[model samples]
Target chain A: MMRIVKDIMARRELLVMLVIRNLKIRYKDSSLGFLWTLLGPILMILIYAVFLRILRIEVALPVLVTGIFVWQYLAMCLGDSPNAIIGSTNLVKKAAFPRLMLPLSIVLANFINFLFSMVVVVVYVRVAGEPFGQLALLPVALITQVALCLGVSLILSSLNVFFRDVQHVIGLLSMAWFFVTPVIYDASLINKVSANPDTQFWLNFLFHLNPMTGLLALYRSALIGLPAPALYLVIPSVVISGLVCLAGVTVFMKFQGRFADEL
Target chain B: MNSDIAIQVEGVGKRFRLRHAGTRTLKSVALDMLRPGKRTVRDLWALKDISFSVARGKTLGLIGANGAGKSTLLALLAGTMEATEGRIGMCGTISSLLELGAGFHPDLTGRENVFLAGAIMGLTRNQMKKRFDAIVDFADIGQFIDQPVKHYSSGMYVRLGFAVAVEVDPDILLVDEVLAVGDAVFQRKCLKRMAEFRHQNKTMLIISHDLNTIQSVSDEILFLDHGRILGHGTPESVIGQYESFSRGVTTSDLRREWGTREVVLTGAEFFDDGGRETSKFKWGEALNVRLHYEATKPVGPSVFGFALSDENGRVVNGNNTQIEKVEIPGLQGTGSIVLRLPSLNLASGTYLFSFSAHSADHQVNYHRLDHAFAIGVDAGKRFEGVCYLPCEWRLDREGAKP
Candidate 1:
């Protein structure tokens, strides 16, 4: 890990160039550029709100918008990063450097986009009558989310090099994981559906088993003035995220020598 | 390997598992992992026991057919890939032009890509800032430096790629057929710049089919065949060995037979006046090509031509019996035809000669030999050009001579 950090420091210019390229290619031929970033979260929140209204659920509007924005950033990184190494096969085949940067760059680039979307989140938070007193903890939550995404992205991107089907699997998994993560609903609502013992067990287990549960709870605590997440969610999330990161980096470095040949 | 060698490879080899084509699946990988004995992993060794070293400031020419591990060796030197076995050590910074425009983003302008490529080659942003103008000037793609690289022609792309690579001032440069991409004028300019790089005593490893470039620029050459070094020595001697290896190759199917003529070239050999069979010729040496043909019909105005082609596929010399009107009368039986030249003056390295026989009407080509044999010219004495001409020089009396 230290060696990789050294490589990143030495190759900082290339990383910066890649970041700029990602930005340019994203907005190159578009009109009303960068509005799309805010539009994505807004549209998702609006759709979810309409569904919740039809269902007559009494969820807080501020919590709904916050969940949607934070969740969308995770979804974007999860979907895009699975193919990060495959997408940058150009650099992999021709040059030698730390391979983890390919996915890390994707995470960082989207993190920047997520930061941009925060303006919309701030506006919606104010309009929805959420207090601004919790704003100081937002950076901490954001860092945790970044770390989580980095770990998962590294794993998926490296796996995609070996099994390209991991890309599609991650794509589908991101969509399914979104619904399970309480993005547009509260965990309390699952209590109503917990009639069967199996259903109750899964609902209770999922709320803690999901790493994003802790990350989202942290965000709500920082931005929406929610209670701190349970110790079970926080401890497991950190442990799993750290293990995923270690496993991802180890596998990536082990198989990296074959990337040029395979590509 | 010598102590002064900047790069050394001792029995370096690389074996790649040739994955079944388009067979990337989680199940297959899982099965292979779980049950290793039942799996059949086809592997290809791209390099095998290739031991060589490049003395500091010396250029090594790596030549071979495709898939002979030339690029694999270059990648090893650049640290792009690790050798599966053995050891490779480089004492200083090494950069590779394995594929021009490799890391450039199509959406980036030429100027931006120059910085990107330079950075990938290990130059700092400020160092690139210092040489930006020189790179732009060297690329010579006027007014298009600000345009996206996707808009540039292939030539301009290569120019920009080469320009940035050169400006990095790499301690060792591995060039893989980069000189073959541009136009003739640009090729000359690139070669000139490469010569300047050589003059600066920078170590270089060049892989090229352009044998002339290899001969002129390389101090030593390694001939690779089927992933192993067949021979290695000074360019002149190794090229001779390669030529002779090509000379003794003969196949029955290669012997051509035409319609009722039944004209089959039974045997072909090149020799000098002494009748000694040889493929190596000194500059200005007497040369002869002997062909044995069996004819089943009487044919008139038959033309037998032999042309010499250099490594670039350019025909340097050729002559036909019809062109010289040295035709023999119609013969109904087997006979021999030999073309003799008083002097053969060609540059050192391999020259391919092909022979063909046809009718005067040019409708029928009875027999043709494609690249029948390669001839080697030793860098002995030379006046100029392909053929050396005798000349006399007179000097005014000097105090030392007196």
Candidate 2:
């Protein structure tokens, strides 16, 4: 592990360059350029807002906007993670460096997009007249979200080299995961669903089981004036994310030697 | 792990698992699981028990045919792939040019790619900036440096890549046939630069199928055949073995006997002055090329000739009875033709002999055997150029100085 860390540090410049290169390529041919970073989340938010207003849903727009944008960041990371190593087979075959940089660069590039779309969340909060008291916790929330995304990205990218179906599976899985999380809806809805004695156990168990459920709630609490979740909920989500990140790094390092052949 | 050694390999090997089924998809994977005893997996050793060490300042050339594990060995040395067994030890930084434009992004400008490629080669941003102009000047693509690399010509792409690679000043350089690209002039320039690197006493491991390049640059040569070292020694001996190995492979595929069989060249041999059959000859020594032929039916009026080609399959020189204006009557039985040279003036390298029997009118060929035998020439003295010309040097003094 120490050697891996040192190797990554030695090639940190390459990691940074790869991230910048990916960002440039992502926006190179597009006319809107960096604005395209927010285009997906903005469009999703607009459609969800119009539909919710038409249905007379009383969910807070600021909460939904922040949740949707963060979820978009996660979705893009997960979707692109599988190709991070496989797509760079040319580099993998020719150059020798820490393979961890590939997936980490993808995660960092998506983090940049996530940070860019945070501007939209700020505007929504200002327009909605939400108090900015808890905004100071935004950095912590963003860090945890990025950690969770990176861990998952690492796992998927490494596995995708062996099983190419991981990418396709992730596409469907992310959608289901998004629906289960409180991205467009409120955490209070899951609470209301858990109010029944017959379904309470399973619903609460699933709500706490998903790392993103706690992360999305935390993001809402930070961006809007939503009440913070219970310590038990927050602690388990943070711990699970950390554990997954550790496991992801371990598994990624273990399989990285075979990446060139598999790719 | 001797300090004088730049690289050490101890019984290193790489194995790849070949899957018979396309297990990439979930459906295929499930199907693979259902077929339990189908033998869907097989092991392939891309490299096996390879062991060699390169000194700190020596240039080692690796020569092998395609799929002979040359690239796999290079990748293993570059640390891109790990050996399944044994170990590889290296000292100092290594920069490998396994492919000319391996990490170049087409959307980026040439200048941007230089920095990016340099970084990928383990150069810091500051180091790249310091050497950026030198790399650009070396690449010599002036205006195109600012243009997107996608629009650049392939030559320009390779130039920029080679430029950045050589400028990195790695302690140990690994190159794999990257010099095979670019035009002739650029190739000469790259070779000159590589020579300069060698002069600086940097250790280099190069893989190339071009025998000339390998012979010229390598202080020692390693010939790999089927993932194992077939021969390793001085460039001359190893290259001789490689040539023989290659010829043996193609000889099986060639039509050994053709042409109506009216007259056939039954056998051929080369004898030295002692009249003993020998393929190895010294420079400026007598060599007798004897060809034995047989006539199935009474046929005659034929000319026997042979061509001496260098190792690269370039015909150097040959002579025929018709060309020499020698007349021969019709023959009715087996006979031999002796073409003797009192002094063979070839340089120190391997030469191939090919024999052909043709009619005196030069209309019909009776039998032709190409690359039939290989002869090795060892020049006792250091001689430059392809063939040695016996000459005496003379000097005239214009003014007398005590």
Candidate 3:
């Protein structure tokens, strides 16, 4: 691990160049260019808000909008990470660098997009007259989210090498995860599901297993000034992130031999 | 091994398992994991037990027929893939031109792709900045350098690719048939640069079927066949072995062809006057081309000619049976005809003999082997070009125009 970090440090110029390439290629020929990054979340939030209004949930619009915007950024990064290695097979096979840097670059690149979307959240907070005290907690939540994302991205990109279908499966899984993570609805609605015993247990179990639960809790606390979620959810998210990251790196190294062959 | 040996390979091998097409999907992967069924696995060994060491300042040529595992071995040496069971020790910075434009982006401008390719080759941005002008200059695509590569001609593409690969001054360079795309002039320039690298004590491994170029550039040659090193020695020795292996090859050697004349050549073989089937022939040795031609009808002036060409398709000898004999005698038969050669004075190479049985009026070709048989010319005495000519030379330097 230290060797890889040191290698990346020495090749930091290439890393930055790769990141710049990723950024440029993303918006190279498009007329709208970087605006699409912000436009994507804004459009999604508007569409979801209209849907929620139709359902007559009567929930706070600001909270729902903030949740969707933040969740979209994480979702895009997670979805793209799985295909990062496969997409950059040209670079991976030809270039000699720390192989781990490909996914790390994706993580960093997506984090930039995540930072861009944060502007929308801040706007919502000011309009809703929420105190900025919760904003202090946003950074911790964002860090945890980044960690969780980095870990998951590493696993998916590595696994995609062996089982190419992992990219497609990741796409489907992220969409499914978005619905279950309380991105549009609050988890306190656990009471609504508690009306049914089976629904309540699954709901409770999902809150603990889903890393997005931590991010949603953090976003809620920051935007609506709600208290940070139960310590139980927080602890597991950290442990899961750490373990998945370890598993990702180990699996990636083991299969790194096969990447050039398969690619 | 020399003290400055820059590349070493010991028993390096690569194994690949061919999976069924149905198992390509993720659902199939999951189902196969659960069932654990016995699946038919075909193992392809791309390189096996290959061992060689290249000293600095020397270029080793890798030459072989198609599917001879040449590219796979190059990839293994380039650190693109690991040896399955053995080790490869590489010293100093190594860069490879495995495929022309392998690192290029179609959407980016040629200038942008140059930097991207340089970075991919492990060059810092500043290093690339310093060398960028030299690369663009070497590529020689003036205004097109700023345009996307998609707009450039094929020659421009290969020139740019070759330029970036050699510009970094890598200690060890691995080139794989990438120069075959450029024009002859640029190819000469590339060869000049490679020669300079050789003079500067850099090691190079090049894979090419162009024996002439390989012979001129490489000091040593490693001839590979079926994933193993068949022969490895000086360029003359290895190229000699490769030429023999390629000559008098069977019908399976039909790589690709042109000119459809319905001439399904069943077999082609060469032999000496004593009637012994062989491919190896000494210079100016007695040789005979026995071609088994099957004709549907008796066509007039059905010319059966054989032209021995160099690897680049330049003719050395082109003569027809009609020319040798006054009458080819009309053929309505499904039998065989033998065309004999009195002397084979062609230089050593894998020469292609393309036969064409055309009308005397140059109207229709009854039987045509566009590029059928390949013969090997053993080393002896000959000029270094397509054909060998008997000419007398006198010392006229004192009386020359100069």
Candidate 4:
């Protein structure tokens, strides 16, 4: 693990260059260019807002907007990460570098896109008259989410080189995960639905099992000044994210040696 | 490991598993799990116990036929792939041009790709900046450097790739057939740069099927056949073995005779001036190819022909009695046609002799032998190029009269 870190640090410039190249290629021919980043999350927010309004859910639009954008960032990373190693087979076959860099760069590039779309989050926050004090914790929540995304990206990219069905599976998995996370709906509503003590205990336990549940709640707390989730939920989310990150690196390094041959 | 060694491979090998059905997707893997008997997996050894070493400044050329593990070995040396067994130790930075523009991004401009390629090759940003102009100048694709590389022609792409590879100034360079891409002038320029690198004492591992290129640039040649080292020695000896091996393969492939039996070619032999049958001759020596044929039936005026091909199976020279307008009378018995030359005029290399007997009008081929006889030519003195032209060069000083 130390060696992998050293190798990555040694090739940090290459990692940055790959990320920049990804961003450049992403925006190269498109006329809307960087605006497309914000457009995706905004569209999802608008669609969800209409559906929720039709259903007459009382959740605030700013909270949905923030959740949708963060989820969009994760979705994009997961969607593209599977092809990262396979797509760069040319480099993988010709040059020797830390293969971790390929998926890491994908995650980082999507993070950059997420950062660009954060402007929409700020606007929504202002329009909804949310307090600014909780916004100070936004970076912490964002970092945790990035770590989670990076971990998942690393695992999926390496696996996809050998099993291409991982890419398709991720597509289906992301949709199911989006609904499970508090993206289109608020978590407090679920809390209200499980009003009985016995049902509430199981519902909360099941919700907290999803790392993104606490992450989404944390994002809401930071962006819209919603009440923070309980210590049990928040701490487990952070711990799970860190553990996934470690496992991602471990699994990636383990399987990366076979990438060139499989690709 | 010796400090003087640039690369050392000790019993290195690579094994690959071949699945009958590609398990490259989750669906196939699941199917494979459910249908256990349907899965077929075979093992292929791409390289087996390959061991060799190169000193710090020497160039080792790997020559082999296709699927001979040359690329696999180069990839291992480049550290792009790990050996399934054994060890490879190396000293100094290694830069490889396994394929032209292997890592180039089509959407990025040539200038951007230069930096990207350089970074992948372990060059720092400042180092690339310092050499960026030199790389572009070497590639010589002016103004195209700013355009997206996708717009660049194949030649331009290869030139840029070669330029970046050489400019990295790696202590050890691994090249695998990328030089085979560009035009002749660019190839010469690359060779010149390689020579300059040699002068700077850089170690090089080159894989090429072009015998001339390998002979000219490599200090030593390693010959591979079927993933095993067939021979390794100085270029002359190893290349000699490779030539013979290739000739053996071609001859064995062409061993079957196919032609109408009006006349059967009984024998073909090479002779020196002394009339002694031999398969070896010296450059510029008197050489003769005697073809013996027996007419099975009454035949019209016939022509006996012979062709001489170099080691690469390229016909360097050949002629027939009909083309020479030497008519022969109708024959019903055995006869021989001896094609003699005062001087072979060919360079020192193996040549394959093929003979054919046919009617004067070339309507019917009585019997034809393809690559039937192989001959070796040894140059008496050091010579260059394909064939000796037998000319003299006179130098006159500026103040002196010719």
| Top lDDT prediction, candidate number | 4
TM, every model: 0.80, 0.82, 0.80, 0.84
Number of the candidate with higher TM-score, 1 or 2: 2
Candidate 1 residue lDDT tens string, B1-402? 565888999989999887665646878778789999866458899899999889999999988767888988888887777899999988778778988888898988998888888877877889999999998898899899999999999999999998888888888889988999989988998899889989998999999988788999999999887789998999988865655664433322232334334465666788988999988887678888788887767777677777877655577888788889886555457888988887876677667777777777667777777666677777666455654456778876774843
Q: What is the Cα-based lDDT of residue B379 in candidate 2? A: 85
Please tell me what DockQ candidate 1 reaches. Answer: 0.61
Which stretch of 10 consecutive residues in model 2 chain B shows the poorest summed lDDT? B249-258
Error of 2 at B41 (Å): 3.1
C-alpha lDDT of residue B180 in model 1: 94
lDDT comparing candidate 4 with the true structure: 0.87
lDDT measured at residue B197 in model 3 versus the true structure, 0 to 100:
93
Interface RMSD computed for candidate 3 is what?
Answer: 2.1
Q: Is candidate 1 or candidate 3 better by lDDT?
A: 1
Question: Taking the candidates in order, what DockQ does each have?
Answer: 0.61, 0.65, 0.49, 0.72
RMSD of 4: 5.8
lDDT of 2 by residue, B358-397 (tens): 7788787778887777777888777777777788986767
Error of 2 at A178 (Å): 1.4
Model 3 chain A worst lDDT window (10 residues) = A233-242
Candidate 2: interface RMSD in Å?
1.3
The CA lDDT at B254 in model 4 is: 51
For model 1 the TM-score comes to 0.80
Model 4 per-residue lDDT at B191 = 95
Show model 3 residue runs off by greater than 4 Å: A195-206, B27-37, B248-279, B282-284, B287-342, B345-375, B378-402
Candidate 2 residue-wise lDDT, A1-263, digit = tens: 68878989889999999999988888898899988778878888889988988998777777778788888888888888998998899898889888899999999998988887888778878887887647766777788877888899999999999888787788788889988888888887876754676586567656877888888777778878788877777777888888888888999989999988876
- Candidate 3 docks at the CAPRI level of medium
Candidate No. with top DockQ? 4
